[model samples]
Each structure stands twice: as C-alpha cells, then as structure tokens.
Target: MNTLSPTTAAQAPPSRWALASLSLSMLLPSLDTSIANAGLPALAGTFEASFAQVQWIVLAYLLSITTLLVSAGRLGDLMGRRRLLLCGISLFTLASLLCGLAPSLGWLIAARALQGLGAAIMLALTLALVGETVPKARIGSAMGLLGSLSAIGTTLGPALGGVLLVASGWQAIFLVSVPLGLLNSWLAWRYLPADGPFAKGKPRGFDLPGSLVLALTLGAYALAMTQGHWVLLLLAAAGAGLFVWRQGRVAVPLVRLQLLGDRQLSAGLAMSLLVSTVIMSTLVVGPFYLARGLGLDALAVGLVLAAGPAVAALSGVPAGRLVDRWGTRRMTQAGLLGMALGGTLLALLPSASAVPGYLMPMLLLTASYALFQAANNTSIMAGIDPQQRGVVAGLLSLSRNLGLISGAACMGALFAFATAADVSIASAPALAQGLHASFAVATVLIILALLISHFALGKRGQSGTPD
Candidate 1:
C-alpha cells in the first residue's frame, strides 16, 4: 500500500456527523472491555467455574487485543483505515452476538477473543483517521473528545452492566453492542474518506513472521503473569529479541524500530503505559475494596467508582485547549503530579470509609489521566509523520493494553501474596492491607512516570507540532 507524503495538503475537517460516528465506534470497544466485569459473578455462577477460570473471560480479550494491536495498525496503514474499520465493526458486532448467545464459559471466552481482534483493528485506525481528517490546529481537541468518550464508556460500563443484568441478564451486556456496532459501521461507510496511496509502488506484504513473534512475546508474558510460570518469561524475552531483530531486517517491519528514538514519542508511550497501569489497577481493585471491605452493593460501588472517569470526561475538552495553548509538557506534568497525589491519597486513606475517601482520590486520579491522555496523545501523534500515524497509533494502543494486563495481573498477585493467610477467605482487613500495598506501588510508579516525562518530554510550555 502507498501513502501520501507527510507534507501533502490537509484533508477537509471531518463533519460533526463523521466525528460522532468515530467517537461512537471508539466507545463500543472501550465499554466492552470493562462491562463484563460487572457480570463476572453471574457468569461464574452460570458456568460453575472457578475464579481463575472466569478471569479468562476478560484476560482472553485483553491478551488477544494486546498481542495484535501493532500488526492491526500496520494492516490499516496498508489496506485503508475506513475499510479496516468497517471490517472491525462487522466482526466485533458478530462476535458480540456470539458472546451473548454463548451457552458455555469456554464459548464466551472464545467469542471474546474474536471481539478483541476486531477491537484491535478499530482502535488502531480510529486515531490515525481522526488525525488525518481533522485540521492540525484542532487535533488536540479532537483527541481530547475521543479520549473523553472512551473513558466515559469504560467508566460507565459497570453501571450500565448492572442495569442490563438486573433488567435481562449478563447476556444483555454483550447483546447491547450489536445494534451500536451496526449503526457505527453504516455511519462510517457513508462518511469516512477512502484510503491514501502507499509510500512504495508495490505493496510490501504483511510481515507475518514478525507479527507471529510479536504475538508470541506478549502471549508468553501474559501467560506467565496469569499462570505463575517463570519459563514463559524466558520465552517472552526470546520472542522480544527475535521481534526486534526482525524489525531491523525486514523490508516491511511490523514497527519501525527507529520510531523509539524520538524522545517525545518514546516518552509519551512510556507515560501512557505507566499511567494506564495505575488507572487499570485502581479500576480492578477499587471495586473489590468497596464491595467487599466496605460492604457496598454493586450499584453503590458503581456510583462511587464512576467519579474518576466522569471527572476525566468533563475535563477532556478543556485539557485539550490547555494542550493547545500551554503545551503538552506542562499539561502532562501537572497531570502526572495529580496522579501521584491521588495515588498517595489512596495509599493513606482508611479503606473502611467508602464515600469522600474513596471518591475524592479517584476523581483526582481520573481527571489527571484525562489531561495526560489528551496532551500526551497529541504530543505523540504530532511527533510522528502522517504516513506513519497508523503504526504509532497501534504502538500507543499496545502500551495501554499491556499496562492494563500488567496492572490486573500484578495487582492481583500482590493482593494475594500480601494476604496469604486469608487468601481463600479474603477477610476485609486482609483485603484492605492488600489494597494499601497496591496503591503504594501505584504511587511510586506515578512518580517514576513523572520523572520520565520531565526528562524525556523536554521543557514545559513547548507546544507539540501539529499533524
């Protein structure tokens, strides 16, 4: 596939209708990621599965998407963002239907993996297309809106899932996506632009070997985390080494290794990974603390938990304007500092309190994340050439996915290990102790992210170059 040069004339800004379609398309996958968590208990009861087995329902989807993101992005660059998005929406819709109809846990998990593949495709292209379609001056605002909607979808998942579960069943959560996906696909087909020319004359065929090795690397890492198998770590390392070696040698690499050399882009990616780890860890553990330690019901927990993302959604557009005016570095620094404070608050708060203690910290953390996401995303996308946006978008998505998987696995492990005596029973006190430890760790991670952003992202008040 050929692509237009980076300096080519800017395309017309996407109309509100097109942007709405894209935003809705993005929301589906984001919502799907967390919605199932609200119904995990119901699902476990239905299948008579162990806690570990039921976890795969979420893990399978995350792992599949995490493994395939970079490859999917490259595919979008080669094929066409609009075309790939259409296919993704179709597949995701079908998979959601299958998940809703699945008669067994195994079947639902399998369908979820398919859903992940579709999500990877859609996510990889959404940002690239948005960047390409919108004017450079407005990219920050567009990214902010997109990021805001995605966060809203994720934050709303549990609450929405609760309503569906109460009204119909767990199946309703999956079934809900089917109609949304269809509508999104139709809007995309009607409004989205066609693919651009490739950089080369002939298509550089997909780098199958590199993609396989990359997938193996991530799969091994995730398996090791979930299964507590040390050998898989070595396999993952080997695959990473091979993947890096292949990218340097291959004509059409899955990712261009040189992209990592860009300080801004690299820093943005690193920050995204760490921030996502903290956010996802909070999302995974916060509800447990609320429901189990504080003894709140699902609805109460959902309301309390929604504070962060709600704050994030509200702040997103404003954050984008700040990024445009004050620059990515300053906004990102402020955001990271806010996250650090939020994490610190969580670590110190008495887990017995559910209202102000829990909700305040979450609001701070999530609002900071909103600022960071909009600024950091604009920075990363701006640092790269337009033609390479697809690949970089995939990389960005890869970082977030891996961070999510790591957060869930690592925090779960830490909680279990810290509460070894009460592992089976999971007494409230023990759970509280584990949550404190997890939050402490997250705080430290955020500080480290802050330092990285400071040193690597350059001086404050430096606006990123627009796409």
Candidate 2:
C-alpha cells in the first residue's frame, strides 16, 4: 500500500514504463466515455429500452465519476496512490465484464456506475502520480503526453465502438476494456513506485461526512444538468452550501478550504473549467451545424467532427514541449488567445464555405486546447506539495468535468434558443444562425478566461513563484 515516493526518487527522471502506465489510465476513462456513447443505439435495441432509459448507461458513469473524484484523490493521499490505482483498474475491469454480461438495462447502468467509480480513482491519481514519477523539468512533457493519449482515446472510441458493435454487438464495447484493464493493472503494479512501510504516526482520518455530502451534491447537480430539472438544481445548490459549511468546521476535511487561496491552483482550476466549457461547444453545436447548416450527411458530419479531437491528439506532445520551453504562464496565455482567435473565426465564417471553413477554426481551437491543458496542469501540479497532490489533481479533474457538464447543458440550450426552432428540422439559415451565436458566446468565454489568466498568473509572476 505504498503511496508517496521518497523525495529523491520523486525528483529523479521518470521511467518511460511508469509514464505509459499513467497515460493508459487517462485513456481508459475517456475511451469508455466515447465508446459507450457510440453504442447507445445498440444498447437500446438490445434491452428494448427507451432513449431516456438507455441514457442512464452514460449518465450513471458520469455521475459516479463527478461525485467521487475528489474523495478518491483525498483517500489516495491518506492511504496509498499506487495501491488504490491497482484496485481501481481491477474494479473497472470487473465492472466492464459485468456491463458486457448484463441481462437488462438496469444491470448495465449499474455496472457503468461502478466502472465510473473506478475511473474516478484512476483519473484522480494519474495526475497526482505525475509529480512523483517525472522530474520537475519535464512535467509539461509528461502532462502533454497524458493529454494527448486522452484525446487519442476519445478520437478513436467512436470509430472503434462502431466496428465492435457491428461485428460483435453492444456487449463488445464494454467487453473491450477487460484486456486493457488487465494490462494496465499489471503495468501499474509492476512499474509504479512502491510505497514504503507505513510511517509511524497517528494515521490520517477520513472525512466520511464530507465525502458523503459532496457526493450527494455532485450527484444532484449532474442529474439536474442532464435531466434539466430545476428542483434537482436547487437541491444541489443547498447541498453545496452545506458541504462548504461542513468542510470549514471539520478538522480533517476532505478538501482544505485554504487551498483555494493558492492563486496558481485556483486560477488553473477556473481556467480549465472555462476552457473546457468552450471546448464542449464543438461537440454540442458542431454536429447540428454540419448536418443542417452545411447539408452534410451523417457519415460526412462524423468525419468532419472527428477532425477536432484528431488535431488535439496530434498536437498534445508538441504543445507540452512548447509549454516547457516558453514557460507555463506564457504558453497558457498563448493557448487562450489562439483559441479565442479560432472561436472568432468560427463565429465570423460563413456557412457557405462549408467544411473547410468549419475545419480551419476547429483545428486551431483543438490544437490550442492541447497547449492550454498541458501548460495549465503543469503550472498547478508543479507547485503542489506531495501530500496534497491527489486532492489537487482531483479538483482539477472535477473542475473540467463540471465545465463539460455545464457546457453540454447550457451551450446546447443556447444553440436551441438561437435556432428558435427544433434543431432536427431547422432550416439551413436557422442552423447557421445557431452556429454563429454559439461560437460568438464561446469566443466571449475564452476572452473571459484570458482575463482571469492574465490577472492570476501575473500575480504569480509578481510573487516569483517557481514552476
């Protein structure tokens, strides 16, 4: 049950195998997300379920991960990260098997929820482990590699799932993870640095109440967003207030309130949320624009949409190297500005220009995203202490998840409102209107993020913080 590596080893050069293990952890969760999405139609047919019912297969997974991420990270800090990660991989593998074998929609959804819990552990600890495995000088590169792999998984998932679903049915989509999970488990156990014997001291106590309240709050929020229910949203707000009050009073809180005072960490989280929200617009709005506005068929639309993630995957490692060379703050600002430019182009470009017009802006946006993610993560994690790494990493992931959730809910609504009609049957002019409006708002969001980054990172610079 080893957790934190010795300080000397933590500062040493990273083993390529260790980095590969971490990268795979990132891939599994992201891959599962897109893969499951692609299989929803098949899943619905298999279980004779309504669309609403089958949606739970995805929602359950998201809800579980969103609710439990922070708690999982804090637990890793208290117990042992490597040990917990292996447990997570094993759990995910078993749950995948369960999902594949499920006899009913309810069973599959439940298994997906269990798998998401494992994914939370994996996602949270992978970033935390980065500091332990990689030398500080190459932190950006490592973060970039992880980011790239995540994008690759996302880019590949739908295509892979479609093939599997056609060849072997919906079950194969979930079943695919079993072997990957097994290999990941072995890699993690064999290559990840081992924990030393538990240090002699009073063992850290877990915050059961805080974890429970936070989970409930996040669950409520996720459901509210997905279901579009005002009552659930209100409950989520109340639960959030209660969680904050609880955290302030507890001695061993799940997350220390004071940690938010770190300008770099706080700003990084905020920027990640903002940037991710903007990114989600592509997924939410792009499909409609391509299909209705540009008159692309389903296959053409899919191919066009895939370009963004593909660009992101290809640019990740290079983006990280740029972050390392130029400095995190500089690279961060550059990425934001680049994204804003892309957003502006999307907003201004006429739909008559068709796929090329759409792709130029999207390519810029996704590539800049890779840069922003790598720089932002390295900026925050490079400065965090070992004991708090897990929780901080979890917070980063949580913020991004929340942003994606928020974007999917809000941006989709915005697009619909702009269209002023049913998107499915909207006229080309109406759909183009929606696309322009969405990207305009997205550009605004990026500008806001840039302002925040400027002020926050400027403060960090003034204080002479080292990254």
Candidate that scores best on lDDT: 2
Looking at candidate 1, the ten consecutive residues that score lowest on lDDT are 1-10
Instruction: Count clashing residue pairs per candidate.
Output: 7, 1
C-alpha local distance difference test of each model: 0.83, 0.89
Locate the minimum summed-lDDT window of 10 residues in model 2. Answer: 458-467
Residue 365's C-alpha lDDT in candidate 1?
90
Task: Give model 2's TM-score versus the native structure.
Answer: 0.96
Candidate 1 lDDT (Cα, whole model)?
0.83
To one decimal, what is the Cα RMSD in angstroms of model 1 from the true structure? 3.3
Across 251-347, the per-residue lDDT of candidate 2 in tens digits comes to: 8899999999988889999999999999998999999888888888999999898889999998999988887777888889889999999999998
What lDDT score goes with residue 215 in model 2? 97
Per-residue alpha-carbon lDDT of candidate 1 for residues 1-467, written as tens digits (9 for 90 to 100): 11233543344334676687789878999999889998999999999998889999988888888888888888887887788889998999999999999999999999999999999888888887776566567767888898998888887887799899999999998999999999998888877766666657745678999999999999999888767888998999999999999999999787888889988888888989998888888877777778877888978987777777788988988888778877778888888999999989888888556578878888889888888898888888765776677789999988887787778788777767765545446878887787888889999999999999878866734765333
- Give the clashing pairs for model 2: 2-195
Off by over 4 Å in 1: 1-13, 40-54, 103-106, 200-203, 291-299, 350-354, 415-436, 464-467
